[model samples]
Target: MTLLGDLLADLDAEAAELRSVVAGLDADTWATPTPAPGWSIATQVAHLAWTDERAALAAAARTPAGREAWDAEVARALTDPASYVDDGAHELARLDPTELLAHWDAARAALGEALCAHPSSERMPWYGPPMTPASMATARLMETWAHGLDVHDALGARPAPTDRIRHVAHLGVRTRDHAFTVRGETPPAEPFRVQLEGPSGAMWTWGPADAAQRVSGPAYDFCLLSTQRAHRDDTALVATGPDAQRWLEIAQAFAGPPGPGREPAGCADARSPHG
Candidate 1:
Protein backbone atom coordinates (compact mmCIF):
# COMPACT_ATOMS: atom_id res chain seq x y z
CA MET A 1 0.00 0.00 0.00
CA THR A 2 1.02 3.60 -0.55
CA LEU A 3 1.73 5.90 2.41
CA LEU A 4 -1.72 7.47 2.06
CA GLY A 5 -3.33 4.07 1.84
CA ASP A 6 -1.56 2.91 5.00
CA LEU A 7 -2.49 6.11 6.78
CA LEU A 8 -6.11 5.74 5.73
CA ALA A 9 -6.20 2.18 7.03
CA ASP A 10 -4.73 3.19 10.35
CA LEU A 11 -7.22 6.02 10.49
CA ASP A 12 -10.05 3.55 10.07
CA ALA A 13 -8.54 1.31 12.75
CA GLU A 14 -8.35 4.20 15.20
CA ALA A 15 -11.97 5.11 14.53
CA ALA A 16 -13.00 1.51 14.97
CA GLU A 17 -11.31 1.40 18.35
CA LEU A 18 -13.35 4.36 19.52
CA ARG A 19 -16.51 2.95 17.98
CA SER A 20 -16.08 -0.34 19.80
CA VAL A 21 -16.41 1.48 23.10
CA VAL A 22 -19.19 3.88 22.14
CA ALA A 23 -21.22 1.21 20.36
CA GLY A 24 -22.12 -0.46 23.64
CA LEU A 25 -23.30 2.72 25.31
CA ASP A 26 -26.97 3.41 25.99
CA ALA A 27 -28.40 6.91 25.38
CA ASP A 28 -27.92 7.80 29.05
CA THR A 29 -24.31 6.70 28.99
CA TRP A 30 -23.71 8.75 25.84
CA ALA A 31 -24.83 11.77 27.86
CA THR A 32 -22.05 11.16 30.39
CA PRO A 33 -19.63 14.05 30.35
CA THR A 34 -16.02 13.80 29.24
CA PRO A 35 -12.93 15.81 30.26
CA ALA A 36 -13.46 18.49 27.65
CA PRO A 37 -15.57 21.31 29.05
CA GLY A 38 -19.25 21.19 27.95
CA TRP A 39 -18.78 18.09 25.74
CA SER A 40 -20.26 14.67 26.22
CA ILE A 41 -19.28 11.42 24.46
CA ALA A 42 -22.09 12.16 22.06
CA THR A 43 -20.63 15.61 21.47
CA GLN A 44 -17.20 14.17 20.82
CA VAL A 45 -18.56 11.79 18.22
CA ALA A 46 -20.61 14.62 16.75
CA HIS A 47 -17.50 16.76 16.39
CA LEU A 48 -15.66 13.91 14.64
CA ALA A 49 -18.53 13.38 12.26
CA TRP A 50 -18.75 17.06 11.44
CA THR A 51 -15.02 17.32 10.89
CA ASP A 52 -15.10 14.27 8.65
CA GLU A 53 -17.94 15.79 6.67
CA ARG A 54 -15.89 18.93 6.14
CA ALA A 55 -12.88 16.87 5.13
CA ALA A 56 -14.98 15.17 2.47
CA LEU A 57 -16.32 18.51 1.32
CA ALA A 58 -12.81 19.85 0.99
CA ALA A 59 -11.71 16.87 -1.06
CA ALA A 60 -14.73 16.99 -3.31
CA ALA A 61 -14.24 20.70 -3.96
CA ARG A 62 -11.20 19.79 -6.01
CA THR A 63 -13.77 18.72 -8.63
CA PRO A 64 -16.85 20.47 -9.98
CA ALA A 65 -20.14 21.07 -8.10
CA GLY A 66 -18.38 21.08 -4.69
CA ARG A 67 -16.67 24.43 -4.31
CA GLU A 68 -19.73 26.20 -2.80
CA ALA A 69 -19.96 24.11 0.37
CA TRP A 70 -16.22 24.18 0.87
CA ASP A 71 -16.26 27.97 0.40
CA ALA A 72 -18.96 28.31 3.07
CA GLU A 73 -16.77 26.36 5.51
CA VAL A 74 -13.93 28.76 4.82
CA ALA A 75 -16.26 31.70 5.45
CA ARG A 76 -17.55 30.26 8.73
CA ALA A 77 -14.01 29.58 9.88
CA LEU A 78 -12.95 33.12 9.06
CA THR A 79 -15.98 34.83 10.64
CA ASP A 80 -16.33 32.77 13.81
CA PRO A 81 -13.28 30.57 14.21
CA ALA A 82 -14.07 29.46 17.73
CA SER A 83 -17.81 29.12 18.16
CA TYR A 84 -18.58 27.46 14.81
CA VAL A 85 -17.03 24.14 15.81
CA ASP A 86 -18.69 24.14 19.22
CA ASP A 87 -22.01 25.08 17.68
CA GLY A 88 -21.80 22.22 15.19
CA ALA A 89 -20.94 19.75 17.93
CA HIS A 90 -23.72 21.02 20.19
CA GLU A 91 -26.30 20.83 17.44
CA LEU A 92 -25.26 17.34 16.33
CA ALA A 93 -25.09 16.05 19.89
CA ARG A 94 -28.86 16.43 20.13
CA LEU A 95 -29.19 13.28 18.03
CA ASP A 96 -29.74 9.95 19.73
CA PRO A 97 -26.65 7.80 20.22
CA THR A 98 -27.70 5.44 17.44
CA GLU A 99 -28.21 8.21 14.94
CA LEU A 100 -24.94 9.94 15.88
CA LEU A 101 -22.97 6.69 15.55
CA ALA A 102 -24.52 5.96 12.17
CA HIS A 103 -23.78 9.49 11.01
CA TRP A 104 -20.15 9.18 12.10
CA ASP A 105 -19.78 5.88 10.29
CA ALA A 106 -21.23 7.30 7.11
CA ALA A 107 -19.23 10.53 7.26
CA ARG A 108 -15.95 8.71 7.71
CA ALA A 109 -16.73 6.43 4.74
CA ALA A 110 -17.51 9.45 2.61
CA LEU A 111 -14.27 11.08 3.72
CA GLY A 112 -12.29 8.02 2.62
CA GLU A 113 -13.97 7.91 -0.76
CA ALA A 114 -13.49 11.60 -1.39
CA LEU A 115 -9.84 11.51 -0.43
CA CYS A 116 -9.20 8.56 -2.74
CA ALA A 117 -11.06 10.10 -5.68
CA HIS A 118 -9.49 13.53 -5.43
CA PRO A 119 -6.36 14.35 -7.38
CA SER A 120 -3.34 13.54 -5.24
CA SER A 121 -1.22 16.45 -6.46
CA GLU A 122 -3.89 18.98 -5.56
CA ARG A 123 -4.15 20.14 -1.95
CA MET A 124 -7.58 20.30 -0.38
CA PRO A 125 -9.14 23.36 1.30
CA TRP A 126 -9.70 23.24 5.03
CA TYR A 127 -10.49 25.44 8.04
CA GLY A 128 -6.74 25.88 8.31
CA PRO A 129 -4.12 25.75 5.57
CA PRO A 130 -4.59 23.16 2.86
CA MET A 131 -3.59 19.54 3.59
CA THR A 132 -2.16 16.70 1.53
CA PRO A 133 -4.05 13.42 1.52
CA ALA A 134 -1.70 11.74 4.02
CA SER A 135 -1.75 14.73 6.34
CA MET A 136 -5.53 14.77 6.22
CA ALA A 137 -5.69 11.06 7.04
CA THR A 138 -3.21 11.47 9.87
CA ALA A 139 -5.11 14.46 11.25
CA ARG A 140 -8.31 12.45 11.25
CA LEU A 141 -6.56 9.58 13.02
CA MET A 142 -5.02 11.91 15.59
CA GLU A 143 -8.43 13.38 16.32
CA THR A 144 -10.13 10.00 16.55
CA TRP A 145 -7.52 8.86 19.07
CA ALA A 146 -7.60 12.07 21.11
CA HIS A 147 -11.38 12.19 21.31
CA GLY A 148 -11.38 8.47 22.06
CA LEU A 149 -9.33 9.27 25.13
CA ASP A 150 -12.10 11.55 26.33
CA VAL A 151 -14.65 8.79 25.89
CA HIS A 152 -12.37 6.33 27.64
CA ASP A 153 -11.94 8.68 30.56
CA ALA A 154 -15.67 9.26 30.88
CA LEU A 155 -16.33 5.55 31.03
CA GLY A 156 -13.25 4.77 33.13
CA ALA A 157 -12.21 2.39 30.39
CA ARG A 158 -8.53 1.74 29.64
CA PRO A 159 -7.70 0.84 26.05
CA ALA A 160 -4.21 -0.40 25.28
CA PRO A 161 -1.87 1.89 23.37
CA THR A 162 -0.89 0.90 19.81
CA ASP A 163 1.86 1.81 17.36
CA ARG A 164 -0.72 3.60 15.21
CA ILE A 165 0.07 6.69 17.32
CA ARG A 166 3.27 7.06 15.30
CA HIS A 167 1.18 9.15 12.90
CA VAL A 168 0.38 11.54 15.74
CA ALA A 169 3.94 11.50 17.05
CA HIS A 170 5.08 12.25 13.51
CA LEU A 171 2.63 15.18 13.31
CA GLY A 172 3.88 16.42 16.68
CA VAL A 173 7.45 16.51 15.40
CA ARG A 174 6.40 17.97 12.04
CA THR A 175 4.39 20.77 13.71
CA ARG A 176 7.15 22.09 15.94
CA ASP A 177 7.30 25.23 13.84
CA HIS A 178 3.51 25.65 13.75
CA ALA A 179 3.55 25.47 17.55
CA PHE A 180 5.72 28.58 17.86
CA THR A 181 3.98 30.25 14.92
CA VAL A 182 0.58 29.98 16.63
CA ARG A 183 1.90 31.91 19.64
CA GLY A 184 3.13 34.74 17.38
CA GLU A 185 6.68 33.66 18.03
CA THR A 186 9.41 32.78 15.58
CA PRO A 187 10.29 29.11 15.05
CA PRO A 188 13.91 28.25 15.47
CA ALA A 189 15.85 27.86 12.23
CA GLU A 190 17.48 24.66 13.40
CA PRO A 191 15.43 21.49 13.72
CA PHE A 192 15.08 19.54 16.95
CA ARG A 193 15.68 15.78 17.17
CA VAL A 194 12.91 13.62 18.65
CA GLN A 195 13.22 9.98 19.70
CA LEU A 196 10.23 8.13 21.11
CA GLU A 197 9.76 4.51 22.13
CA GLY A 198 6.67 3.09 20.53
CA PRO A 199 3.89 1.14 22.29
CA SER A 200 5.68 -2.15 21.63
CA GLY A 201 9.02 -0.72 22.75
CA ALA A 202 10.34 0.05 19.28
CA MET A 203 12.11 3.38 18.95
CA TRP A 204 10.97 6.02 16.47
CA THR A 205 13.26 8.94 15.67
CA TRP A 206 12.98 12.11 13.60
CA GLY A 207 15.20 15.05 12.64
CA PRO A 208 18.99 15.11 12.48
CA ALA A 209 20.91 12.80 14.79
CA ASP A 210 23.27 15.58 15.88
CA ALA A 211 20.64 18.24 16.58
CA ALA A 212 21.37 20.10 19.84
CA GLN A 213 17.75 20.39 20.91
CA ARG A 214 15.93 17.09 21.41
CA VAL A 215 12.89 15.38 22.88
CA SER A 216 12.91 11.75 24.00
CA GLY A 217 10.50 9.44 25.82
CA PRO A 218 7.60 7.06 25.41
CA ALA A 219 5.59 7.73 22.25
CA TYR A 220 2.44 7.44 24.32
CA ASP A 221 3.41 10.38 26.53
CA PHE A 222 4.48 12.48 23.56
CA CYS A 223 1.25 11.73 21.72
CA LEU A 224 -0.80 12.82 24.72
CA LEU A 225 1.20 16.00 25.13
CA SER A 226 1.09 16.77 21.38
CA THR A 227 -2.70 16.45 21.41
CA GLN A 228 -2.86 18.59 24.58
CA ARG A 229 -4.60 15.71 26.26
CA ALA A 230 -1.89 15.55 28.94
CA HIS A 231 0.24 18.18 30.61
CA ARG A 232 4.04 18.13 30.49
CA ASP A 233 4.14 17.41 34.22
CA ASP A 234 2.03 14.33 33.56
CA THR A 235 4.39 12.93 30.89
CA ALA A 236 7.82 11.39 31.41
CA LEU A 237 9.09 12.77 28.09
CA VAL A 238 12.42 14.62 28.39
CA ALA A 239 13.43 17.78 26.60
CA THR A 240 17.10 18.61 26.23
CA GLY A 241 17.15 22.31 25.36
CA PRO A 242 15.17 25.50 25.93
CA ASP A 243 13.61 25.24 22.48
CA ALA A 244 12.69 21.61 22.98
CA GLN A 245 11.23 22.26 26.44
CA ARG A 246 9.27 25.23 25.16
CA TRP A 247 7.93 23.16 22.30
CA LEU A 248 6.53 20.62 24.75
CA GLU A 249 4.92 23.45 26.69
CA ILE A 250 3.01 24.63 23.61
CA ALA A 251 2.76 21.61 21.33
CA GLN A 252 -0.50 21.30 19.36
CA ALA A 253 -1.08 18.72 16.63
CA PHE A 254 -4.46 20.07 15.60
CA ALA A 255 -4.98 23.33 13.73
CA GLY A 256 -6.27 26.70 15.04
CA PRO A 257 -5.04 28.65 18.07
CA PRO A 258 -3.04 27.26 20.92
CA GLY A 259 -5.13 24.99 23.10
CA PRO A 260 -5.72 25.29 26.83
CA GLY A 261 -3.71 22.21 27.76
CA ARG A 262 -4.57 19.85 30.58
CA GLU A 263 -3.66 21.15 34.01
CA PRO A 264 -0.97 19.40 36.00
CA ALA A 265 -1.80 16.95 38.77
CA GLY A 266 -3.46 18.52 41.84
CA CYS A 267 -4.80 21.39 39.79
CA ALA A 268 -7.17 18.93 38.09
CA ASP A 269 -7.81 15.23 37.59
CA ALA A 270 -4.65 13.38 36.53
CA ARG A 271 -6.41 11.05 34.03
CA SER A 272 -3.76 8.64 35.10
CA PRO A 273 -1.94 5.59 33.71
CA HIS A 274 -3.06 6.46 30.19
CA GLY A 275 -0.19 4.50 28.61
Candidate 2:
Protein backbone atom coordinates (compact mmCIF):
# COMPACT_ATOMS: atom_id res chain seq x y z
CA MET A 1 0.00 0.00 0.00
CA THR A 2 0.97 3.64 -0.51
CA LEU A 3 1.83 5.95 2.39
CA LEU A 4 -1.61 7.51 2.26
CA GLY A 5 -3.23 4.08 2.23
CA ASP A 6 -1.23 2.97 5.24
CA LEU A 7 -2.12 6.12 7.17
CA LEU A 8 -5.80 5.83 6.34
CA ALA A 9 -5.86 2.24 7.54
CA ASP A 10 -4.11 3.19 10.76
CA LEU A 11 -6.56 6.03 11.34
CA ASP A 12 -9.54 3.71 10.94
CA ALA A 13 -8.06 1.08 13.25
CA GLU A 14 -7.23 3.62 15.94
CA ALA A 15 -10.68 5.13 15.77
CA ALA A 16 -12.26 1.72 16.02
CA GLU A 17 -10.23 0.88 19.11
CA LEU A 18 -11.30 4.14 20.72
CA ARG A 19 -14.93 3.54 19.83
CA SER A 20 -14.83 0.08 21.39
CA VAL A 21 -13.67 1.55 24.68
CA VAL A 22 -16.45 4.10 24.79
CA ALA A 23 -19.18 1.90 23.34
CA GLY A 24 -19.97 0.25 26.63
CA LEU A 25 -19.75 3.31 28.84
CA ASP A 26 -22.74 4.47 30.82
CA ALA A 27 -23.85 8.10 31.05
CA ASP A 28 -21.85 8.60 34.24
CA THR A 29 -18.74 7.06 32.71
CA TRP A 30 -19.08 9.31 29.69
CA ALA A 31 -18.98 12.34 32.02
CA THR A 32 -15.89 11.14 33.89
CA PRO A 33 -13.04 13.63 33.84
CA THR A 34 -9.97 12.62 31.89
CA PRO A 35 -6.27 13.39 32.31
CA ALA A 36 -6.75 16.46 30.15
CA PRO A 37 -7.63 19.41 32.36
CA GLY A 38 -11.35 20.23 32.35
CA TRP A 39 -12.22 17.70 29.70
CA SER A 40 -14.56 14.76 30.21
CA ILE A 41 -14.66 11.48 28.31
CA ALA A 42 -17.45 12.90 26.17
CA THR A 43 -15.50 16.10 25.58
CA GLN A 44 -12.57 14.15 24.15
CA VAL A 45 -14.75 12.33 21.67
CA ALA A 46 -16.59 15.54 20.81
CA HIS A 47 -13.35 17.31 20.03
CA LEU A 48 -12.36 14.48 17.71
CA ALA A 49 -15.75 14.70 16.00
CA TRP A 50 -15.43 18.45 15.49
CA THR A 51 -11.90 18.13 14.12
CA ASP A 52 -12.81 15.31 11.75
CA GLU A 53 -15.78 17.27 10.42
CA ARG A 54 -13.60 20.31 9.83
CA ALA A 55 -11.02 18.17 8.08
CA ALA A 56 -13.64 16.71 5.76
CA LEU A 57 -15.04 20.14 4.96
CA ALA A 58 -11.60 21.52 4.29
CA ALA A 59 -10.83 18.71 1.90
CA ALA A 60 -14.10 19.23 0.02
CA ALA A 61 -13.83 23.01 -0.24
CA ARG A 62 -12.09 23.93 -3.52
CA THR A 63 -13.66 27.32 -4.13
CA PRO A 64 -12.66 30.75 -2.77
CA ALA A 65 -15.74 31.00 -0.57
CA GLY A 66 -15.13 27.56 0.83
CA ARG A 67 -11.52 28.39 1.66
CA GLU A 68 -12.55 31.72 3.20
CA ALA A 69 -15.11 29.98 5.38
CA TRP A 70 -12.43 27.68 6.77
CA ASP A 71 -10.11 30.60 7.33
CA ALA A 72 -12.88 32.42 9.19
CA GLU A 73 -13.50 29.38 11.36
CA VAL A 74 -9.78 29.13 12.19
CA ALA A 75 -9.69 32.84 13.00
CA ARG A 76 -12.58 32.38 15.38
CA ALA A 77 -10.79 29.47 17.00
CA LEU A 78 -7.68 31.60 17.41
CA THR A 79 -9.62 34.33 19.21
CA ASP A 80 -9.68 32.29 22.42
CA PRO A 81 -7.02 29.83 21.36
CA ALA A 82 -6.61 28.38 24.82
CA SER A 83 -10.29 27.67 25.22
CA TYR A 84 -10.95 27.02 21.54
CA VAL A 85 -10.97 23.23 21.87
CA ASP A 86 -12.87 23.13 25.17
CA ASP A 87 -15.48 25.54 23.81
CA GLY A 88 -16.15 23.31 20.82
CA ALA A 89 -16.43 20.33 23.16
CA HIS A 90 -18.92 22.20 25.36
CA GLU A 91 -21.13 22.84 22.34
CA LEU A 92 -21.15 19.17 21.43
CA ALA A 93 -21.72 18.16 25.04
CA ARG A 94 -25.21 19.55 24.76
CA LEU A 95 -26.17 16.45 22.84
CA ASP A 96 -27.03 13.07 24.37
CA PRO A 97 -24.10 10.73 24.91
CA THR A 98 -25.36 8.35 22.25
CA GLU A 99 -25.88 11.24 19.88
CA LEU A 100 -22.31 12.42 20.38
CA LEU A 101 -21.01 8.93 19.66
CA ALA A 102 -23.11 8.69 16.51
CA HIS A 103 -21.85 12.08 15.38
CA TRP A 104 -18.23 11.03 15.90
CA ASP A 105 -18.77 7.75 14.11
CA ALA A 106 -20.27 9.53 11.11
CA ALA A 107 -17.68 12.29 11.04
CA ARG A 108 -14.79 9.85 11.34
CA ALA A 109 -16.15 7.72 8.51
CA ALA A 110 -16.60 10.78 6.30
CA LEU A 111 -13.11 12.02 7.04
CA GLY A 112 -11.52 8.67 6.17
CA GLU A 113 -13.38 8.52 2.88
CA ALA A 114 -12.66 12.16 1.99
CA LEU A 115 -8.98 11.79 2.76
CA CYS A 116 -8.62 8.60 0.73
CA ALA A 117 -10.30 10.26 -2.24
CA HIS A 118 -8.16 13.42 -2.09
CA PRO A 119 -5.12 13.87 -4.33
CA SER A 120 -2.05 12.83 -2.38
CA SER A 121 0.02 15.72 -3.75
CA GLU A 122 -2.51 18.54 -3.20
CA ARG A 123 -2.27 20.35 0.10
CA MET A 124 -5.31 20.76 2.30
CA PRO A 125 -5.67 23.89 4.43
CA TRP A 126 -5.53 23.44 8.20
CA TYR A 127 -5.15 25.67 11.27
CA GLY A 128 -1.41 25.43 10.89
CA PRO A 129 0.47 24.80 7.64
CA PRO A 130 -1.48 23.14 4.87
CA MET A 131 -1.05 19.33 4.85
CA THR A 132 -0.93 16.82 2.06
CA PRO A 133 -3.34 13.88 2.27
CA ALA A 134 -0.62 11.68 3.78
CA SER A 135 0.23 14.19 6.51
CA MET A 136 -3.42 14.87 7.25
CA ALA A 137 -4.18 11.20 7.63
CA THR A 138 -1.16 10.69 9.86
CA ALA A 139 -2.22 13.71 11.93
CA ARG A 140 -5.67 12.22 12.37
CA LEU A 141 -4.15 8.94 13.51
CA MET A 142 -1.95 10.75 16.00
CA GLU A 143 -4.90 12.64 17.43
CA THR A 144 -6.99 9.53 17.66
CA TRP A 145 -4.27 7.67 19.54
CA ALA A 146 -3.59 10.61 21.85
CA HIS A 147 -7.24 11.14 22.72
CA GLY A 148 -7.63 7.41 23.10
CA LEU A 149 -5.14 7.66 25.93
CA ASP A 150 -7.38 10.18 27.66
CA VAL A 151 -10.36 7.88 27.38
CA HIS A 152 -8.43 4.89 28.65
CA ASP A 153 -6.99 6.80 31.56
CA ALA A 154 -10.41 8.08 32.51
CA LEU A 155 -11.65 4.49 32.72
CA GLY A 156 -8.60 3.24 34.61
CA ALA A 157 -7.67 0.96 31.78
CA ARG A 158 -4.26 0.47 30.23
CA PRO A 159 -4.34 -0.22 26.53
CA ALA A 160 -1.57 -2.31 25.04
CA PRO A 161 1.03 -0.65 22.83
CA THR A 162 0.95 -1.51 19.15
CA ASP A 163 3.25 -1.19 16.15
CA ARG A 164 0.86 1.45 14.84
CA ILE A 165 2.67 3.90 17.11
CA ARG A 166 5.50 3.79 14.55
CA HIS A 167 3.47 6.32 12.56
CA VAL A 168 3.25 8.75 15.48
CA ALA A 169 6.90 8.21 16.35
CA HIS A 170 7.82 8.97 12.75
CA LEU A 171 5.77 12.17 12.88
CA GLY A 172 7.43 13.13 16.12
CA VAL A 173 10.85 12.69 14.56
CA ARG A 174 9.87 14.63 11.43
CA THR A 175 8.48 17.52 13.50
CA ARG A 176 11.76 18.12 15.29
CA ASP A 177 12.28 21.37 13.35
CA HIS A 178 8.67 22.50 13.79
CA ALA A 179 9.02 21.99 17.51
CA PHE A 180 11.98 24.36 17.54
CA THR A 181 10.46 26.89 15.13
CA VAL A 182 7.28 27.12 17.21
CA ARG A 183 9.36 28.16 20.20
CA GLY A 184 11.38 30.69 18.13
CA GLU A 185 14.54 28.60 18.44
CA THR A 186 16.88 27.62 15.67
CA PRO A 187 16.87 23.91 14.81
CA PRO A 188 20.19 22.13 14.61
CA ALA A 189 21.84 22.03 11.19
CA GLU A 190 23.08 18.50 11.87
CA PRO A 191 20.33 15.91 12.25
CA PHE A 192 20.05 13.90 15.46
CA ARG A 193 19.72 10.14 15.36
CA VAL A 194 16.49 8.68 16.80
CA GLN A 195 16.58 5.02 17.74
CA LEU A 196 13.34 3.67 19.18
CA GLU A 197 12.31 0.17 20.22
CA GLY A 198 9.11 -0.56 18.36
CA PRO A 199 6.17 -2.48 19.81
CA SER A 200 7.17 -5.69 18.06
CA GLY A 201 10.71 -5.44 19.38
CA ALA A 202 12.06 -3.97 16.16
CA MET A 203 14.36 -0.98 15.98
CA TRP A 204 12.96 2.02 14.14
CA THR A 205 15.54 4.65 13.26
CA TRP A 206 15.77 8.09 11.64
CA GLY A 207 18.65 10.44 10.74
CA PRO A 208 22.30 9.37 10.54
CA ALA A 209 23.25 6.01 12.04
CA ASP A 210 26.36 7.43 13.69
CA ALA A 211 25.25 11.02 14.32
CA ALA A 212 26.84 12.87 17.25
CA GLN A 213 23.41 13.62 18.74
CA ARG A 214 20.98 10.82 19.48
CA VAL A 215 17.63 10.01 21.11
CA SER A 216 17.20 6.46 22.28
CA GLY A 217 14.29 4.84 24.13
CA PRO A 218 11.03 2.98 23.83
CA ALA A 219 8.92 4.32 20.98
CA TYR A 220 5.94 4.60 23.35
CA ASP A 221 7.70 7.04 25.64
CA PHE A 222 8.90 9.10 22.68
CA CYS A 223 5.34 9.34 21.38
CA LEU A 224 4.11 10.53 24.76
CA LEU A 225 6.91 13.12 24.95
CA SER A 226 6.36 14.33 21.39
CA THR A 227 2.63 14.76 22.00
CA GLN A 228 3.15 16.47 25.38
CA ARG A 229 1.12 13.78 27.08
CA ALA A 230 4.09 12.88 29.31
CA HIS A 231 6.71 15.13 30.82
CA ARG A 232 10.31 14.66 29.73
CA ASP A 233 11.65 13.82 33.19
CA ASP A 234 8.91 11.21 33.66
CA THR A 235 9.99 9.22 30.62
CA ALA A 236 12.91 6.84 30.04
CA LEU A 237 14.03 8.49 26.79
CA VAL A 238 17.69 9.54 26.77
CA ALA A 239 19.12 12.46 24.82
CA THR A 240 22.84 12.45 24.12
CA GLY A 241 23.44 15.99 22.84
CA PRO A 242 22.32 19.57 23.47
CA ASP A 243 20.07 19.64 20.42
CA ALA A 244 18.53 16.27 21.27
CA GLN A 245 17.80 17.39 24.82
CA ARG A 246 16.16 20.58 23.64
CA TRP A 247 14.07 18.64 21.17
CA LEU A 248 12.78 16.38 23.96
CA GLU A 249 11.95 19.43 26.07
CA ILE A 250 9.72 21.03 23.42
CA ALA A 251 8.81 18.28 20.99
CA GLN A 252 5.30 18.35 19.54
CA ALA A 253 3.70 16.00 17.04
CA PHE A 254 0.49 17.91 16.57
CA ALA A 255 0.01 21.20 14.74
CA GLY A 256 -0.98 24.65 16.04
CA PRO A 257 0.33 26.47 19.12
CA PRO A 258 2.77 24.88 21.52
CA GLY A 259 0.90 22.80 24.09
CA PRO A 260 1.14 23.31 27.83
CA GLY A 261 2.56 19.90 28.52
CA ARG A 262 1.39 17.79 31.41
CA GLU A 263 2.78 18.51 34.86
CA PRO A 264 5.64 16.25 35.89
CA ALA A 265 4.18 12.88 36.91
CA GLY A 266 3.57 14.15 40.47
CA CYS A 267 5.77 17.16 41.04
CA ALA A 268 5.46 20.94 41.15
CA ASP A 269 8.63 21.59 39.14
CA ALA A 270 8.83 19.64 35.89
CA ARG A 271 12.59 19.41 36.21
CA SER A 272 12.43 18.02 39.75
CA PRO A 273 12.17 14.26 40.01
CA HIS A 274 9.83 14.67 42.97
CA GLY A 275 7.82 17.55 44.36
Index of the highest-lDDT prediction: 1
Q: What is the C-alpha local distance difference test score of each model?
A: 0.88, 0.85
Task: Evaluate model 1: give its lDDT.
Answer: 0.88
Candidate 1 per-residue C-alpha lDDT over 90-209 given as tens digits, one digit per residue, 9 for 90 to 100: 899999888998999999999999989877777888877898887898889989899999889899876899999999999988888998998999998998899999999999999999
Query: Candidate 2, which ten residues in sequence have the lowest lDDT sum?
Result: 266-275
State the displacement of the C-alpha of residue 170, model 2, in Å, after optimal TM-score superposition.
1.0
lDDT of 2 at 220: 97
Error of 1 at 246 (Å): 1.0
Off by over 4 Å in 2: 63-72, 75-82, 268-275
Total backbone clashes of candidate 1, pairs 3 or more residues apart or in separate chains: 0
Q: What is the alpha-carbon lDDT for the whole of candidate 2? A: 0.85
